[model samples]
Target: MNQLLWMAVGAGAVLSIEGLYWLYWRYVGSGSVRDYINEDQEPEGDYRILRKIKTPNQRIALVEYRGQMWIYGNGDVMFSTTEDENMYAEAMVHIPMAAAGKRNKVLIIGGGGGVTTREALRYSEVEEITAVDVDDVMLEFGKHLEAMVRFNRGSLNHPKVRTVIEDGRTFIENTPMKWDVIVIDVPEPTGRYPRLSRLFSVEFYRLLKERLEPEGAINIACSTSFWMPEYFWSIQETLKKAGFQVLPFHHFVPEDGEDWAFCLATTSPVDTDGLRMLVSTEYLTPERLKDMFYMPFYFANGQNQGDIQTDDNTVLLDIVSEADYEQDGNRKEYN
Candidate 1:
């Protein structure tokens, strides 16, 4: 009976030790062993940004994580792989460039990967491209990375392409020249840097409005359709208030779950038929343009209203709070 009691105590002690080890591994030591192995391997498909290269500005080392690529900017995971860099760049750049009709002088804000610049140059109509990125290392990585360079097709070194290492907001504020089209591909707002947050602010959109040519348009990378509904609507509302006729659209990215949203704003009407003439891709079509305008009920319900107090007023702030009221017990309001 004493031996049996000893055996039970021994078993209990072993279980306790194992439980403590598990907790330490799970919370403190590191992630799971599988994650550790994946990190060491740096697998191709599941790329994530492990660290930021601060010497040459805030450039990120993107690696595969959980079957998706994530970009770490300044030790924070800024962007996650929702769609391929090529696909996202193409949509963000091509759509606005095509809609603008003639691309004379283009300005790209926050396209660290150089993907947007690559896509913009695809239109032979473009005379010059001014790409403003805060990180120089991102450009270096884009040049060296076979997949990224191949996808961009050496557009980064195009004759008309001139690289400018500067903050987008500062550049916009100081530059006297107007652009035919402006594409903003900056990080999402975590409310850390007010400049990045300002992109979604009324003042920033107003600045964009000022810099745009009469017929020119702008495209902004909003945010994930799934996670941050309020952030997305706020941007759309702010753009509208800044005197732009805003069209919020989204596409599915396999890396990022569900759907991704982008806001395209213009002073002039978009000639979807005319825009379709420039692209030879399977994605952009007249039919697709028509479909792009059709907002989902959940998204559409968030549009800004005239009376609602919002970050912007010129454009309708889709009253998302009311939508929350309507949703009642069904959905929780996204922060």
Candidate 2:
């Protein structure tokens, strides 16, 4: 019996050591997914990775899915869609722009693919489009890549457009130019991406309020209210605390596999009665704009008990990290 017990203990120790090593080798030792897969061979079954870009900040992958191209940052699909409709981009820029009425100088933060800038240029009133992003690699992709340039209507290279490779918040802090329409198209306030969540904080919004024209309006991509409601409303509350009258709205994005929320904030009244498009678009209409503003009961009351995000408090990260959300495209279970 003693000998049998010794053998059992020895076996368990060996198995545990082997399991730990396997984990390290698979995750830590392996540099990235690109390192494991052969570049020449199609490794993701239905989806094929065309190119992978390594920046100091993140790993970017240009993927081809069902004959369509998608840009993914750190395993998540970017908000910009390749489709002509580009519902997300149109909705984010136009409604607030229409409200502002005479927006000449527009500021876009985190315009990764230049799609947001593309939508902004549709307004004939917009004279200058300043796109600021921390990732120069992404900016270069927007400037030169055939697929990205095609979808973005060559907005990055447009004479009226200027691309700045700097942290959005830092640029805003230093720039003397007060913008007419400010569009915040950043990633979700999750831990995977660093420093960006700070953009959603009250202090940061206050900085935005400082740079914004009195009559100017701001729009933000507020992540998924369908799954992570707490994170959504906390951001809504943070914006309000920053001294702006806020209007929270949402739309279903097929790429994200959920309903994504957005906040339209203004120093003045949000009177979009005169909303009209200066250029042609496939998706956004007056009727649809009315529907987009409708928030359901669950989404309206999402912030049950949470403090506003602050520079020192770190509340948003705690909430975002604890939330259980599913992004369909991020996993092997893409449908």
Candidate 3:
């Protein structure tokens, strides 16, 4: 009788926990969870979960939301969406690619989804492209998973592309090989991300400069310019302190309905005034590309408000601890 009572208590606890989860799921938006749980929930309206993967480094999910498929990292980090990925990808990849005159041997750091690689492959001059990510599983998904394969268009498996599973900063530090263009398509260091925050430091960019060819350039995805103005400027300032000529620009992602900014950094002299695309683009033309440099009125004014980000003094990490991004009454939710 006692044993039966204990079993009943355990079962009750389980049921109660599940009930709470159900309530949270019902109330909140699609989760950005750290736990390895594939939420294969039933299709609610236009939202459905397609896949979930657990890597030693990160939790990944592929969900179909609002007639578009989206990939989320750690439940919150929306890596890419089928909706306007091309617009963001083109803006991220093309500027730096155009800056690099040789356009051969490009290195894409942290874009395991392969969207950036897909854009880089557009240039016929690209002889060898290396795509590196910390999560090997995500790269496998991009290379093999049917939905990801379709989305990335098998760019990971191209003969000209080589996939490496490694930390982006470590790879840059160790490799003797120099690249014509290096695309930093990693997540923004907005939260308490120790590892990721390190990547934004002056130290990392200086090391990256060493790996870049004299005529080469790099493009880093500096989170939303409007939402986190200070952080955005900090990244640009950080790059400048690292001894690179920084050209800050932004483009809108329709799915998120927010302005995502990017920076083109190079030690080489860049003629930002006469920038043009060497390859044809689906979304970004040369005219639009040049115009991206025009900053929002308020955002332009705060360009000098940033402190240089460093490994020891992580201003970028400290500025984004949930409370800072609380605009109006809406809580900060990157997903």
Candidate 1's error at 18, in angstroms?
Answer: 12
Candidate ranking under TM-score, highest first, comes to: 3, 2, 1
Across residues 1-335, which tens digit of lDDT does each residue of candidate 2 receive? Answer: 99999999999999999989887774467645543232322224677667877787777877776766677675566633446338778878877787774689899998868888988888777899899988887888788888778888899899999899988878988888889999998876555565777788898999999888878989988876365677777888888889988888877666645676898898877755556755666777767767777776656744443468887776777766555334333422211
Q: How many residue pairs clash in all the candidates, one count each?
A: 18, 0, 3
Which 10 successive residues of model 3 have the least lDDT summed? 34-43
Output candidate 3 Cα RMSD.
6.3
How do the residues 59-137 of candidate 3 rate in per-residue lDDT, one tens digit apiece?
Answer: 6777777756566665454455454677878888988988886798899988788888988998888899999998887
TM-score of each: 0.72, 0.81, 0.83
Q: Rank order by lDDT, top first? A: 3, 2, 1
RMSD of each: 6.4, 8.0, 6.3
Candidate 3 overall lDDT versus native:
0.77
Off by over 4 Å in 3: 1-21, 24-46, 190-192, 253-256, 301-303, 322-325, 328-335
- Each model's lDDT comes to 0.65, 0.75, 0.77
Task: Specify the highest-TM-score model's number.
Answer: 3
